[model samples]
Target: MGRAIALGLPLLVVAEIAVFVLVGSWIGYPWAVLAVLAASFAGLMLLRREGMRAWRGFIAAANSGQHPGERVIDGIVGLGAGVLLTVPGFVTALTGLVLLFPPTRSVARRGVQRWTERRVSSAVAGDLFGPRKVRVRRGAPDVDGAIEGEIVEPR
Candidate 1:
């Protein structure tokens, strides 16, 4: 992940710059600048609205004695979308808008959930998102199942 980010960041910047230049050439420099500014402003508004909605949902969940995990995840998604929108790039803004809309947001939410489940332990994921059904496979009984490990004492 770290390596991907290290490479992806630069690539994203290059893509953003290229897109900006292309758009500018097609629609004139001033219009391109205005478009960027407009996107940023729209992002700010979305951030504020989503932030409040997330906060309210979190509070409501807590008050109702329900797990706030889903709300927390929603809040994270909203925050990310807002930040992406605020970034000065068409690519980021488009990605943010995708997250903002309901259908796309749900898709993004599921993706995040799946990613989280993969990265986190089952126990932790269960605590956050509730229990998940897991499939267990039986190995051959004749095969040795003992594991080997070496524990080094700290000097």
Candidate 2:
């Protein structure tokens, strides 16, 4: 799987470059290039604004000593979106924008969860709730009895 993704990344990059060039040529290279630059800049601006808001909310959540798990997850996701938004391409910018928004991210999270549930061959009941460690059966308990996080581990 790792190898496949590694190989696929360059292929995707090539495809994106081809599309960019084709569209740029059709629209006139100067205008297309300018548009790409403008969109990338706009994306970065939006990311900065959203990130600030999310940070403020996180600070508030942490101040109250409430579960800050979701905020941390959102921060991680936002950071990734920030990186993608900086890439010079319409498709990546669109995806990055979708990820930057809360409603869209919620939908994406559900889709990813469904994918994960299907990938696992055997059901591990109380799996996420159970201790993640593999130790002596009678060793000290490890479950924190909390909704630890909202991180979506990549496939």
Which candidate achieves the best lDDT against the true structure? 1
What is the TM-score of each predicted model, taking all chains together?
0.81, 0.61
- Model 1: per-residue lDDT, tens digit, 1-155? 89999999999999999999999999999999999999999889878988898899889987987767678788879988998999998999999988878898777777787787778986887776766664445555445774434322112
* Alpha carbon RMSD to native, model 1: 7.9
User: What lDDT does the true structure give each of the candidates?
Assistant: 0.82, 0.66
Residue 18 of model 2 has an lDDT of: 86
Give the lDDT of residue 49 in candidate 1: 85
**Which lDDT tens digits does candidate 2 get at residues 1-155?**
89999998898799778878898889988987897798788778867876886788678877886655455446656766776777898677777878967797876655554454446532331132222232234445458733333323333
Cα lDDT for residue 31, model 1?
A: 96
Worst 10 residues of 1 by lDDT: 146-155
Candidate number of the best TM-score: 1
Name every residue pair that clashes in candidate 1. none
